[model samples]
Target: MPFLLAAALCSVLVSVLLKLARRLEVDVGQAIAWNYVVAAAASMLVFAPAPSALHAATAAWPALVGLGLLLPTIFLALAGSVRHAGIVRSDVAQRLSLLISLLAAFVLFGEPLSAAKGWGMAAGLAALTGLMWRPSKGAISGGAAGWIYPLLVFLGFGVIDVLFKRVASAGVPLGAALLAMFVLALLVSLVLQGWRLARGTARLGARSLAAGLLLGLLNFGNILCYLRAHQALPGRPALVFSGMSLGVVALGALAGMVVFRERLSRINLAGLALAVLAIVLLARG
Candidate 1:
């Protein structure tokens, strides 16, 4: 339970760090690249001696590689989503990823879905619809791309979750698997950023680097807590993870209102309420 709470807190911190990065004029791309680098380093330190057994656990290699390719795109989409939509709306949209993941788990892994889970899914969908129902007439950036980014982010994260579960179940030590995954993701991010740098389009200045490092550290904390939660409770990580997601979104909403002075529309407020109820149902499930 304490581990779950830590995971939730870490998730909240990640959201807050991202919000701070935006406020500080940090280059999102560079920061994201640096974030992966730091996160890889942190994971290595946590699981120092890369075990030879991990080599034998190569059955999930393809999935891990695919995940590596998807990760940077996920971050890019999430950053873009936050840029176009506010944090509250972006997070609300992002939580919809859970539905995708749950369905994938059910179909691919044969995870069971009870009546409570069904109710939870319904509530979550309601929340997402409410959040996205923007009635105000204003020119939002990214247009159609804005909507696409969040959905892509959701798909990417769902893929990662399914892959991670498969890898973990296939005899890979959680620590080793996490380290390898982060390292691969970092390499992908670096190559992408390097290409941008070569074109003189990417900024690698001090502020961006610092923000990236901070975001990376926070991300490391989140990964650590998540891995630990999974390790400690081998079955039904979804409940704990759903709780963490709710905590992060709630905290993000609060920060949005307090620090950014962002006003929530009636629809958004209703979305928040529905999200809370969905999490409760999820936990019960």
Candidate 2:
């Protein structure tokens, strides 16, 4: 439980860091590229070459590779979503990943679906719809790219969670699994960035580097706690993840109000209240 709580706090902090990175004029791709590099290094230091860890890591490479490939896509889509939709809306939409993974667990992994899980999923859906509902401004609205990006991000994350659980069940050491995943992701990012630099499509700057380092640290802590929580309570990853998502939203809202001075409309305020209620139900369940 404490591990899960720690994971929730770290997840919330990651969201705050992402918002801050934007204000600091950080390039999202660069930040993500560096984040995985640092995370991989940290995981290797913590878990690799300890004799006992080698066997688990050897067996986990396949799932880890799959997870690694999904990560960049998830981050790219999430960043795009945050750019198109507001941060609050993007965060709310991404929380729907929990429902996706829960369903996947039932259908694909043979996990039992209880009434409490169903209710939790319903509450999550209601909260997401409420968050996305917007009052018309009586003008031509944009197309569905914004919505599609976030939905894709949600699906990517859901797949990641399922893969993580599968690897865990297969006796893969979490730290080793994370290390492999990040290393592969880092190599891919480097290749992509190298191509961009060669084509003169992007230039690396000091601000971008610094933001990447900071995001790297935050992401490392976030994944560490998340994996620990999932390992500590394998039966309730969805519940823990829901709590973490709610914490991120609450923290994001507070940060928006304080740092961005973003005012919430009456409807948004109501949505926030429902989000809180959903969290309560999730925790109680």
Best by lDDT: 1
- For model 2, how does the per-residue alpha-carbon lDDT over 2-46 read when each residue is reduced to its tens digit? 765676556555556665666778777888898887888888786
lDDT of each: 0.75, 0.70
List residue ranges in candidate 2 displaced over 4 A. Answer: 1-6, 20-23, 49-60, 138-146, 227-243, 263-271, 279-285
Question: What TM-score fits each model?
Answer: 0.88, 0.82
lDDT tens digits, residue span 1-285, model 1: 677677666665666666566678888778888888898788778877466867888797887787787777788877776666656766766666777778877788888998998998899888877766655463444566655665676677777777777787788876677777777888888888899989999767899898889888877887777767787888877666776777678767877677666666687689789988887777777
For each of the candidates, the C-alpha root-mean-square deviation to the true structure, in angstroms, is 2.5, 3.6
Worst 10 residues of 1 by lDDT: 133-142
Model 1 Cα RMSD, Å?
2.5
